[model samples]
Target: MPKVRIVDIEDRRFRVFSSPTVPGGREFVLVHGIGISHRLFSRLHRVLSAKHTVHTLDLPGFGGMPRPDSDPDIADMARDLAEVLERLGIGPVVAVGDSMGTQWVVELGAQRPDLVTHVVAIGPVADARHRTLFAQAAALGLDSLREPPSANARVLVEYARCGPRWYGRQVRHMIDYPLEQRAAELVPPLLVMRGGRDPIAGPEWSRAVARCAPRSRFVEVPGQPHLVQHTAPRPVAEAIEWFLAEVPQ
Candidate 1:
């Protein structure tokens, strides 16, 4: 079993689940969305770790980590992640993010392109169609109808652990982040993915995000919901592998 390692970055600390690096294999870093931890990517980690080194991160205030004095915005989180990667001496890895995780990945790609070779954002969040809290909630409610029971159970558990106050603060930061603008600044090869039936990140939003980056492609997992990475880990992993193969190292 992979154990958690605490990494200090200035005043803040992060909990990391790191696997040993494989010889001649690429390093992959997984980032989870708001109010959730690396647990969300356990299946994906298991699949990828077979052939490559995988590092799943639990940013501050999530995954049982102590909350900071105030909630850090998406860019703040990205900056801290960039610093963490630099201190860890891992570079040129494919950074994979899900939901609100996309904002962190995009900002990192823009801020520290040297650290990330390729980017994969699954079910990226805050579609322009639903900008406000109510609208986003509505979309989430609609999509919840399509998600699997296991996914719902896991989400509930994670949310309860996150608590209402912290989760609400994180949501505000997530929805307020200028994802598209920062995505356009990404220097790494970017791949945008979402579930075909995902109400939050629908076709239009996914296409728009893809267009933000010059070298980007949009792919969808058919018949899946917002938590497609969990529901269809194989396909998502396959897509990421294909993208990694195509991207120049």
Candidate 2:
């Protein structure tokens, strides 16, 4: 496992990632969800590292990366990610985002339509109203959503690195971000997939995202949870590989 590398892209500190992905392979950037860092996709990263140069980022305030106290919202994070990509000279690259990262995918694809060519989203929250759906998770008494494989141990540490106060603030921002209407506007060649047993995002939600974007396709994986990439990296990576290969030219 390669330790994450940090780079001062412009003024923001970015934890940049790059995998060999074969001698002469293409590159794709992986973006993680809230409270989770690049480590969320560790299993998938290792799997795909052989075929595609994989890149992940430790967005500000969420993975030991300095976050702006004032810009403590998804919009700000999106802008930061865009700058990170531009500064690193890594645009027009395939982007695979999960959950919160999916929100950034919408932001980046909409704002910088020319920058990101393809997007693969797993367990994505299509609309902000869906945020309320998470509260019900606690009600269901499901521990799976709270705990994942040890690979995500780093995510817990990264969230802790940001502290509870900041973490709560970010959650509040996400719950209040008014996402659905705007996300519907910027579809971009998207692949929205959900876990079959995912309490956070079920089939209806995935369908809504697919409907929101005519170009987007919705896939449902049976017997998986919120951590689709972690619980089943093979399927997630396979879906991503297929999407990348089938991307519209």
Candidate 3:
């Protein structure tokens, strides 16, 4: 089994997951959304790690990495992640992201084209119009974190990985960054997947993105929400596999 490697850049350190596969076949560097750790894809990682080298990193200000000193934008994070991929000798590898993470992958495609091969945006949040709605909805969902109809304490701990300050800065950055332009810069053959019930980046936004990236395709997983990767890992992985399978080696 390929274990996690901790990479230190200057004063910051990030976590990465490597696969058992030698030669790192079809590397997938997964950048998680705001305030989340690579563990979010624990199930998918365990499965994919068996084949391609699956590298998942903790963005600064989220997970085990130290909080970023400034209100960093997605581009900055993408560039930083690009360096990580380079150090791992992982590209032109496929880049997979969800929500905020997905947006970052778009930025990566725009700024560091050489690093990303196929792009997978799952439950992508391409703008503020959708984010404000989702944030409000997440706040409301937090209110019901009790039992039966509420989220558990453990998930709450996972949610806290973003930390109040980090999460706040992320929301601020998301508002300032112009994602529509970035979404349009995709290099083509982009795979966009959104959960049917994901309020943050619903079907409408997914379709919009598909239209924006003329070479893109969209898929909606039924009964899933913004965390489609978690709610339905198998299908998400399958979608990615299908997309990568078609990519010219």
lDDT of each: 0.86, 0.70, 0.71
Deviating ranges (above 4 Å) for candidate 1: none
Candidate 2 accuracy as TM-score: 0.85
How displaced is residue 160 in candidate 3, in Å? 2.4
Candidate number of the best lDDT: 1
Alpha-carbon deviation at 166 in model 1, angstroms: 1.2
State the local distance difference test value for candidate 3.
0.71
Tens-place lDDT per residue, model 1, 1-249, is 775678876656798888877888888889998878888898899888988889999888787887777667888888899888887777777999999998899888888888999999998888998889899889988987999988877888887887888888889988888888888888898999999999999899899999988788888999999888888889999998888777664
Clashing pairs in 3: none
Q: What are the clash counts of all predictions, listed in order? A: 0, 0, 0
**172-216 per-residue lDDT for model 3 (tens digits):** 666566666777877745888987666667566678876777467
Model 2, 21-78: lDDT tens digits are 4556666788888777877788888888878777877776677777655654667767
Superposed model 2: Cα runs more than 4 Å off: 1-5, 8-12, 21-24, 126-130, 133-155
- Candidate 1 has an lDDT of 0.86
Instruction: Please report how far candidate 2 places residue 15 from its true position, in Å.
Output: 0.6
- The lDDT ranking, best first, is 1, 3, 2
lDDT of 1 at 8: 74
